[model samples]
Target: MDPCNRFRMFLVPFVMGIAFIFADVSQALALRCTALSGDDRYSILYTVQAMHQAKIQRQGALITVFEIGGGDPALNGALLYIRIEHNDQAFVWKTGLNVHSIQQLSTGPENTLDIRAKEDFLDSNNMVISREVSYKIHFYLNNDTLEDAIFVENSPKIN
Candidate 1:
């Protein structure tokens, strides 16, 4: 091959590789996350709870929620930040507006997420004063994202 042809061949593949790299980066950057406004409501202690993917059987391929700063298993006022992965994209929703001691995490009806927990009634100082009620909150998972959560029980609003 002539010198010009050899140089052209090398340049073409290099340019193609660079383009491929940029495409992959853009795809990763396409993760759409909801507003994490009140994420600082909880303490810094976060515990990772990884669930079995086959059990849920939803649009999310992997689901993980980090438990934030609650020690007592009985009346702990813990918060959660959920992360869902689907189709190589990730979505996060901060479940931190209320005080909950997560008792169970499982699949709910209609392919939703079932988070069974005891609601902690906190005093003005963010201390758990009472654990009077339990709640079952359902998080709807769509094709590429998790929808707004719905809950039945009324808990003290965290500011």
Candidate 2:
């Protein structure tokens, strides 16, 4: 066969193989979080206690926070998220929230008085990076209703 034909065959298969590989990797990273609610602190704290039971849950760096201020105004519910760790350092993707669930989050040593998601800790990210991951909205109680909607979102990529 001509050199042109040989190049076409090799390139086509190589490109297709790469596409397939990426598709599979993305699918594997997909995850889901179940929603739970409670009027008092015990119920809310119980949910977190159950989530952190595993030994090597995400298997990278562990990023955790307990916020006690008004939940960020942009978002309504509380949240927990996981992200891909970068170079064995802080996480790269979602930070502490690459994958997380939220709704009026309350936390306290998994035993002390529960703290709301709006608490200063949860509403903001640590100051290690030049650009900060900001919480658009956070509030302990919604003016309209206590009911909150769980949202699915993708994390921003950093190069």
Candidate 3:
């Protein structure tokens, strides 16, 4: 084989290999969220409960994550810049500005946020929800302050 042709052939495969690796990595980035529901209200406005420690994990992986959430009732928009901090971690996670459009909390339930496990919670695009892990959720009632953070425990209901 000519030296120039051989070099070209190697380069093509090298680039193709790199591209394939990236494609596989990207495929791991997926969000698997469960449906949540609850009917709670706030004094000033009103609040509803969503999923509890809902785990969004990679199909065959594990991730360190905490479910933090917030939404505005007055503006009827997802309240961003709200505070969300972990008990063991010092860094705080700011709530995203995306919410469902509906007037008043529904009698039924709905999915709040699509929980996806990721390598870094600080980066949205790096998430890959793990389906093997379970999530825990906390609930709370809002009056006029943001100090109230309610956490609920999920257990097998006894009929």
Candidate 4:
């Protein structure tokens, strides 16, 4: 057998294996929000109390907002669990925001889902230690995913 033939065989299998692994990982990360079982979805909804939803049809994205309520206003303003779904992939982020509204805004190369909220600066015990401020989180579309674009702009906003 030629040395080159052996090298080709090894490289082909190695490449195929890597591809398979990545394919599985990509699938695993996709459709997570939509794939939630009824029980799990209901559990989250029940525990979280208040929920809101918004959609971006152009980007094939859906966003669900869950307000984690119960604490006193002085102790905390709001904690929100945000789930963003684009096609089959979904991204989740948690932040200290009381969502006032959600809006779709676009300009040039940027298509964004803007979440308007009142943000509370809180302490360890969930107390609002500072003045509440208004914030707009802009989630931009990139390559069919809605997670990375907002990560940089909203890093400080997320708890």
Name the best candidate (by TM-score): 4
Per-candidate Cα lDDT values, in order, are: 0.48, 0.30, 0.28, 0.49
Which parts of model 2 have CA positions greater than 4 angstroms off?
A: 31-159
Ranking by TM-score: 4, 1, 2, 3
Error of 2 at 4 (Å): 1.3
How many clashes in each candidate? 0, 25, 12, 3
**Between 1 and 3, whose lDDT is larger?**
1
Error of 3 at 77 (Å): 36
TM-score of 2: 0.22
lDDT, ranked from best to worst: 4, 1, 2, 3
Error of 1 at 136 (Å): 5.5
> Residue 113 in candidate 4 has what lDDT?
38
* lDDT score, candidate 2, position 60: 24
Model 4 Cα lDDT, one tens digit per residue, 28-119: 23121213333544455555756677776666577777776654545343455666777687656654344322222221124443444443
lDDT per residue, candidate 2, 93-134, as tens digits? 121232122222222231111212211122123222122222
Cα RMSD to native, each candidate? 19.5, 17.4, 16.3, 16.7
In model 4, the runs with Cα more than 4 Å from the true position are 1-46, 73-77, 98-109, 117-133, 152-159
Candidate 3 has its poorest 10 consecutive residues by lDDT at: 102-111
lDDT of 1: 0.48
